[model samples]
Target: MTENEREIVRRITDVLEKMASGRKPSRIEYTETDAPDDSTLMELEAKVVELNNLYAESYRFILDLARGKLNGDPPPHNNFVTPFKQLQSELRHLTWQIEQIAAGDLDQMVYFSGDFSRAINQMIDDLREREELRQQLADSNHAKDKLFSIIAHDLRNPFNAIVGFSEMMVQMVNMASPADLKQFAEMIHTSAKQTYNLLLNLLEWSRVQTGRIDVKPMEGDLALLIRTNVNISSITAEPKQIQIYYDGGDSYPVTTDAAIFNTILRNLISNAIKYTPERGEIRISVDTNNRFYYISVHDTGMGMSEEDVQKLFRLDVIHTTNGTNQEKGTGLGLILCKEFVTMLGGDIYVESEKGKGSTFTFSIPK
Candidate 1:
């Protein structure tokens, strides 16, 4: 464009600015008569070109800024709902898997393949191992039931014969000479007593295995229980010349299952008598502290070694050794004692050396 045209446009803008400021220009500035020099014309043209470039760049910048702002905004709520719903569903699925495992469904599996997946797989493996262990326990119990059943059925014959034949033998002995009758009666009595004791142990063990027995805990006199057991066992102890003694501290009252406790006391005392040598003495004692009572039965008997002591209370090991007096036991009595003691929240342990005396200590809550 020529200098004239450039001036006209500039004048036009000045007029508009003055009008916007609410002021009128002193005079009109437009002119078609003055012709600019060559240098002035080129300068005017450069100014026009600069203004056009500035406006075009500014418009492009504003358009790009608007587009950027739109991109920075968050997605629509509807667009987010699906993924959010998916996350909630996954959490619910995990919670259900945990519940199933807690409820003992060992076979259930969680379909996850992350760090949590490894832990879930480990838990399932542990449950499977536990189930296998439970099955093994059931099989062992079944075998025990079968063995006890056989023992129970087989026991009747000897018991019946001993009772029946002994009564007739007594009649025959009474008819015999005085000296002969005394020996026969004594033999019959001894045999009957042995059979009775065996039956008692057998029945008690069976009751314990079947979970039929209920232990009733109460305050009891331990000293009385010991003395009574010693007296009852003397019949078996006397012939072996094994003197049974109760050296327990004064009347000790302990909280325990009375009937079961009595059984434990009787069995231990009789077992001591059964195992001890001639002239050996068995001492029973009760020691007490602040929280518990310790009842120990010590015997100068053919004591067991470490191996026998280890397997002593296990039903499967069957550690049965004949007493010095040839007295026999089913090896169930000690196992029953341990079971009953555990049920009463008590424990039994033995300390012994071969040929040395054995001490069996049991503790009950006071």
Candidate 2:
């Protein structure tokens, strides 16, 4: 080799050694005066520089990916970067799935290979189970609170009235007129009746919560059931002169749980009588579709606001108001009605406007 050839070979060896030692190598420039052997060395130097440039590009891309920077310039489309491009695509898709999971979509799943896929899928399943348990806990707590409220306040109030009126009656028996004695007896009877009804509802609600009540559907006369409930409710309505009008024929057939149906009707009729003013009217009507029977109990009474109507039949909220004669309530009856209706394969709803009357409608499979 000539002196120029040796010099070119030495420079290329230095660059190669630096690159091998993990250091940035100095660039080798082409010269004007070169032998054939020097030209071959220069070509070898150009190949080395090209390889180093490609290495640097790949290194930067890998570093960015390691740092979780997904928006950086992508690596060149070569054999060296093919695996990295696939990894980046997977990471982008994983980011979207994580976002969806955070936004309450627990249906997301990762299908990547190995431990990462197993861990992520397990995490999603655990989150969904935890959310369902949380909702159930909330419902249970609401039910507990409602039960305590009724027992502490509603149950106690009627007992107090019963005790006080009976005591007054015993003390006034000798000196009081027949009319005054009759009034006291009536007051005591009303309080006792209220207590009885509250206890019945409390027992029913407890059974419902414990899943003890079973539905027994049998063919029965719907008109006769309505007449019985209305006749029973009239005793309470007579005092206020509020009339109940039901004109269904002698017999209308339905397949339903008779006890549940009776309870629902009794509650609706009693609620109407409680809310209706003196001389107001209550109308019971029934309509039928091919699949269901729609029973409507409409009352001319002081109605509710849109907001108050929305609060009905929810255990989380307690809504109650005094009747026309200052009768007290715990709002449990409506909740029981909702539960029983649902149990009987029916849905109940109400429509009311402020100052106008309310119509409560429930549907039963015919």
lDDT of 2 by residue, 1-366 (tens): 888777767766776777689764344454534555566666776676666656556767767888998766675654566688788888888888989999999999888877999998999999999999999999989999999999899889989988898888889889999999899888888888888988899899899999999999999988888888889888879999999999566777898998999899989888888888999999999888898888999999988999999999999998899898888898999999999999999999999977778999999998
- Backbone clash count for every predicted candidate, in the order shown: 0, 0
Q: How accurate is candidate 1 locally (lDDT)?
A: 0.72
Give the runs in model 2 whose Cα sits over 4 Å from its true position.
1-52, 67-71, 76-82, 99-107, 247-252
lDDT of 1 by residue, 1-366 (tens): 776666756755654565457442233322343665455544554554444333333433334433542222222343323443454456567778878889988778787658888889887998899899998798578548645643774455446656765776667864777677666667667667777877787788778777899978887877777788778887768788888888886688776788888888888888888888899999988888898788899999999989889988776665678788776666777888998888878899999988987999888887
Per-residue error for 230 in candidate 1, Å, reads 2.8
Task: Enumerate residue pairs that collide in model 1.
Answer: none
RMSD of each: 17.3, 4.4
TM-score of each: 0.60, 0.81
Task: Write down the RMSD of candidate 1 (Cα, Å).
Answer: 17.3
Candidate 2 has which clashing residue pairs, if any?
A: none
Which stretch of 10 consecutive residues in model 1 shows the poorest summed lDDT? 69-78
The C-alpha stretches of model 1 lying farther than 4 A from their native spots are 1-181
